[model samples]
Target: MFIYASPSVERMYGATVDEVVERPIQDSMTPESFQKALQVFAEEMALEQTGAADPMRTRTIELEEYKKDGTAFWVESTLSFVRDARGKAVGVLGVSRDISKRKAAEAEKERLARINRQLQRSDSLARMAAAIAHHFNNQLQVVVGGLELAMNQVPENAKVFATLRKIREASRKASDISRTMLTYLGQISGARCAIDLCGVCKNSLPQLLASAPKTVSFETDFPQEGPVVLADGEMVRNMLANLVINAWEASGEGAGVIRIAVDTVEPAQIDSRHRFPVDWYPDDTRYGCMIVEDHGCGVIEADIEKLFEPFYTTKLMGRGMGLPALLGILRAYGGCITVGTALNQGSVFRVYLPVFQGKPSDTMPHPVSMMQQYPKNIGVLLIDDEDMVRDIAEMMLKRLGYEVIKARGGKEGIELFERHHQSIDVVISDLTMPGMNGWETLAGLRAVDPQVVVILSSGYDEAHVMEAGGPIDPPSAFLGKPYRLQDLSRCMQDVLGRFQKPSECPGDRLQNALQEMPDGAFHKNSAEGT
Candidate 1:
């Protein structure tokens, strides 16, 4: 029993002094705290029974204490036994000081440390994903390129052609998976154009509904038009699918409804609730927002911070790449996501995208197209650390009617280019090589012949590679790995077309072309590397 409490107790615990005086101390403590206090008191009493307990010695304890208003706080208390005239222990004397501020500071420090650790883990996972995606995309390139070569050999009417086409499609999907892994690392490469958010969602809803279980139903609220954003349409579709699928799954095995809506939101309306890229904020005054609401098993508070982590999931057999990739996409677009949820109530995920201010071009150029024929005398220097990729690439070059010289790595490629600088009209070098990388190889080749045309190739997309600002002396062109005959041929045409003749060096011709073409017209080795 407290017997008495000072006026300070009311100030510390939000209770009046009279309300706490003469009351059982247990009433002011949590069940766990009360039990702990009882154990300590019993231990002290046992020591006192042996006459070994020092009456002047004070025992200190920190506990969570509550007051009349039910508000809890931390307090550090010191206790000593009060003695009679003959030194017999009577009552206990105790003094307590509120330590809520110190406790809160400690808690906040621990939380920041924990968040820093999570970021490090996420970074490590992202790097690992990049490495895996790099290698996987390399292999996929070979599969896709080889399949294209095989398909060309067989007539389209042949049964083998159909089989090859199916295999190629499957390989392309595999390539998408690798891209998703790269997306998680925020290294995805694709064209972005202004598109209506509501339209994209509506187009995706049919497929989403078809793929989802019958127990799940969808309710969509979309304005007829507008709320456009400058983003990759395919990636936006993938993001929508990811959110809707996650909502459906979270809705549980029983029947449930998921509501999806798109609206324009003012920047002021957005909050920082568990936003990814914690340092990011809305760059625009208005945002095109997509909200996904579900009446499923709402995310618990503990799991909210981890929802965007790659492969971290509460569900069994969850691959867990969806939300992470979505975050990556948002990060790339200078956007952010906010989450709201309560246990057993449901979750609402609001994805805010920066609104596009200008109108998109009426006609968008294709990313890849068939190449026109080039002179057979034109030569290419092909470099790669991978034997399979190099050999197949050489074959692809030859199939496009160009003389091919193969080099195992960047050093060898530079040597070959130096030896045959005049003969080699173009150099296609792999970006990730063991001894010397493509960037270093490009520099070396340019040192030998300033006009040398070098195509830097990588499993990563050209946009991602160029996003790092590229080399001081950039390559003439960028070739994404796993390219087919058409891709190789098209790149060759684009490179060679800059010059009037294949025999002459492109320096003078490039200068003339630059003079004639509009600003930003040059695609190869120019400021617009991508």
Candidate 2:
């Protein structure tokens, strides 16, 4: 029972002293709070009745409390048991202070800390991904290059050619996966050129549509011209593909529609629609925007901010790298992405890329054919740590009618080049090696002959290699590993043909090259002997 009340009760519980005095304390509390306070009161009464030595005289607790108006707030209450001179409890004296604001602030602080930790973990994973990609690409080069050379030797009609082609195709798929990993690691490969946004969408549509289930239909609305962006065409396609696939999967197994549209967006419009940082865009600029919308179960509001976070997914089997990689590619080119979603309604993912100012140029390289006859007397020094790769490359050079010299490693290759620098017209050097790398070998060769026509080959893309601080002096030409015979032939012709004079005999063509190869052709040859 409340025997007395102070004026503070008016502000704390919306009751004046006169109204609260002599009223049961439970009358001022909610049913839950009343029950909890009664239990504690009963426990103290029992302690007093038993005359327990050093009994609890006071207690503090935090709980939800309500005012006369029924508004609830958290309160920290300290209750002191009043006792008579004989040590028998008579009444209670309590004091409480509102701590709601402090609790709310602490909760917000904890939420921010969780987000910070997640971002830190993401950064660590990105670094690990980069290291893995570098090493994986190195080993993949050997597998791909060796398979490519073996396929070249097999006749088109041979039984083994079909099997070898399938293996090479699988290897190429593995290469694609590695490239995706690099993208997630914040490594964007390929040159940036002015590319037509509409054209990329049109080209990617067939594949994207084919991947969707039959229950879903796709609609596209692209401007005929004028929305061009300076970006890698392949990366744009990949980003579109991922967005479309995500929409397709989200559309459920029932009949649905996936809509893709492209338009030009002003900086002001972007700022109004997205919560991106103020520095994300320039004050006056236009962006080429691609929007992919789907009629499906949309993401919840709470999860929207986390959609681009690495390895965060709502799906059971998802590895969660798709959206992160897409975002990484966009950010690499000073672009951004925004999304809109509603539960059970649908979702819209908008990708914005900075608009290119000038007229778009055709940056795609013309395909080169390797079926042409080779000019004779050209020499190539093949350097590789892997014996299989070295032997296969030697066979490829021999078939192309070039005099070949093999080196097991970069150090030996440099020595071999020094001894036969004049004779070696071209050096085909592997990028990753045990002792000395391709860059070092290139540097050593350039010291001996500045005009050294060296072709740098690697499993990794040229951009990724260069970004990782590869050779300062770029090679005459670059050959991506796992290249076909035609690619090798064209590269050699392009590099060697530039130096050869009109009077020089075209390299002697090897008649019946595959059929006439001796058994010793597969044997490893030391750099000293070559």
Best by lDDT: 1
Put down candidate 1 lDDT per residue, 1-530, tens digits, no spaces: 66777888767777677778856777888888889888888989899899876767889998888867888888888988888999888889889998989999998898678768777887898888888877887777778877876776799999888889889888877887787778877787377788888888988988998999999998889998868888888888888889888888888999999999999999889986577776567764799999999988988888897888877887765588899999888877888889999988888999989998876433367564453555554667778888788767766666666655678888877776665566567888888888787788888888998877788888786767777535465677888767777777888888887643644753443344434433432222312110
- Cα deviation at 208, candidate 1, in Å, is 2.7
Candidate 2: give the clashing pairs: 375-506, 375-507, 376-506, 376-507, 376-508
Q: RMSDs, each prediction? A: 7.4, 7.6
Clashes of each: 1, 5
Q: How far is candidate 1 from the true structure (C-alpha RMSD, Å)?
A: 7.4
In the range 382-439, model 2's lDDT, one tens digit per residue, is 8888776776677667666677767888888887777656556788998888778888
Model 2 / residue 327 / CA error / Å: 3.2
* Model 1 alpha-carbon drift over 4 Å, by segment: 13-16, 22-59, 65-72, 79-93, 154-167, 223-228, 263-273, 278-287, 314-318, 359-364, 367-371, 448-451, 470-474, 498-530
User: Each candidate's TM vs. the true structure?
Assistant: 0.81, 0.69
